[model samples]
Target: MDYFFAVVAPLAVVIIGGCTVRSVKIISEENEALVERLGKFHRKLESGLNFINPILDTVVLEDTLSERVLELKPSQAITKDNVSLIIDAVLYWRVIELELAYYKVQDIEEALRKLVLTTLRSEIGEMDLQKTFYSRKDINKAMLRELDDVTDRWGVKVTRVEVQEITPTPKVIEAMELKRAAEFKKQADILEAEGTVRAMELLSTAIKSQSNSKDILQFLVAQRYVEANQKLSESPNAKIVFMGSEPLGSSMGELLNNSTISPPESNGSNSKSK
Candidate 1:
């Protein structure tokens, strides 16, 4: 009886242990899990061990899925005006639909890669190089919106799309740089001309105010005389000096004496003399 009881006790303990054994589902702090019961989705589960119908329930990994990244290769495209350009971009995205992401597409990575390439080419073809470079943020946003709208049904959300780089031909870049430089030079010239006009107007006002003012003229003349003397001192030749206003008056008087004053003769004068 004791031996039979020991054998039964060990067997009962093994059965209970097997029945109580639970599958541990480990989840990271940043993750969530979706559980299925007999091929039907039941509910989402948080981190730690939760009860499941042993053979009938299974946990689907929603967090283990890698974040999708789409890299668009450089492609040749024409602008609105028929100018050619090479453009490339990168897109960041992830699957929000665990069911659709796994079921809708055969290969999510391959599908996204093809979609990104096609979308990029189509979008870039409609824009010019100038618009492509200058309005890149707008372009990226537009692409993101379009991709998100299309991919949402497939359980994908486009988090971000960015224009990584744009390379214009060397000739086009050089032409643009030259055009900018010329515009800057033209503006500088216009400003310089305006300044010259302003300076001339101020000088004219000064001259008009000083007009016929003997004191001011005398002062200017004295200044000029001083400058002239200083310059003459540098010359090797001797300068002829005429002293003051007195010498100028005497010279003029001598010139007047040398000239004769002639009077007109008339018939009336002759009659009066007779």
Candidate 2:
């Protein structure tokens, strides 16, 4: 009887000790785990101390409930207008249902990456190159909507999406620059022509508003003469020749007549004489 008691006591101690180690579960804060009993989901273990039938229970998965960020790789896509562009994006998501997340998807991150890329290309294909740059926010919204729709079944929620970068091809950028320069040059030409027209209109109005247009015309010609001489003086290779002293109005008028640009004044006619 003494030998029987000694042997049974050691076996009982071993059995109790093994059960204690297997049944005890201590999960950290912000962490969760799924327990499966007999090859089927039984319950979820929350943070803190937990007890389980270790003989029939297994901790299937343990992960944090923290938000995660997934940055997508850059990819090339063509716009509706057939312009090629490189695009990259980021996704913010978190697991809300661990069971479905593990059961429904073979690989979570890879699945999300493919889905995001497909949605991105689909959205981009609907817009032109210019609209892509102008409507970045619209693209992000559409991507989030599409991603959420499909990812909902995976037990994850996409909180937000951001289109980080969009770049056109080098050839397209060069073409855009050239097109912009041409537009600027065209506007400058139009402004210059308008300015010339305005100046001519003002000169006509000034001349017609005066009682004696000939006096104003003579003054204008004299002003032009002095300006021409001033510009010529500034040139290093200019040759300024002076003729015999004569009234500027007479000399300039004769020069205009000789050049057939305008009729000259007659000196032989007296005042009020036809």
Candidate 3:
């Protein structure tokens, strides 16, 4: 009975130890495993049950290979218009190539942040302040493209770039505001001048079309006379005059004779006498 008990106990312990050693593995929902054999990369393990030889091979490093957000601090940059501004940005990226991401770059986050800043300065340095403020989306897109190109070799993928904040100096802000105001005023003046020119052109066209019509001229003159009469009646110090050709002189001779008036000045008679 003693011999049988010793043999059975040793067999059960060995089985339990083997199961425990085989159960050692990494479990995750959103991660990948890099397996190594003799300190050299052997294969990549996908999500699920991953087995490893605990004695001969081991998990040298555990890395969560997923998308990450890199926030950058404000950096001084010079614009095309010689204005200096501090710009802050955020970068969205992911590690696509786990092999390159883990082995090539020492620190992925730091490298990504530094690359973003360098690319942003180069892009923004070529544009003016107004463009930088308004064209942030466009600039971000361009920076993303540039970063993608440069980082592709390093196995890093840049998903998107965003300009978080742009802070220009107070003096630069004032100058930009003044410049914008002046530009708006110039545009308004141009529009007003165009409207006045259009109105003048229409008036000239109407005058030309009615040059041979006496009725139209008479109506215009009557309208002016009515307006003048109404304005004059509002104030006792105003005087209104509505005149015509020699027809009034011929028909109303008695009225002209009663008033202190002279005949129409004749240039021909005056020149002949001189």
TM-score of each: 0.50, 0.65, 0.58
Residue 207, candidate 2: Cα error in Å is: 19
Off by over 4 Å in 1: 1-19, 39-42, 64-85, 168-274
Model 3: pairs clashing at backbone N, Cα or C within 3 Å:
none
Q: Any idea what lDDT model 2 has?
A: 0.87
Provide the lDDT at 220 for model 2. 83
In TM-score terms, candidate 1 sits at 0.50
- Over 29-117, each residue of candidate 2 has an lDDT whose tens digit, in order, gives 88889999999999999999999997999998988778999999899889999999999999999988988888899899899989999
**Model 1 poorest 10 in a row by lDDT:** 210-219
Model 1: lDDT to the true structure: 0.71
Q: What TM-score number comes out for model 2? A: 0.65
lDDT (10s digit) by residue, model 1, range 14-62: 8777756755556665456777888888876665556665577787655
| Clash count of each predicted structure | 0, 0, 0
lDDT of each: 0.71, 0.87, 0.77
Predicted candidate 2, C-alpha RMSD: 7.0
Q: Which parts of model 2 are misplaced by more than 4 Å?
A: 178-274
Best by lDDT: 2
Best by TM-score: 2
Distance (Å) between predicted and true CA of 141, model 2?
1.8
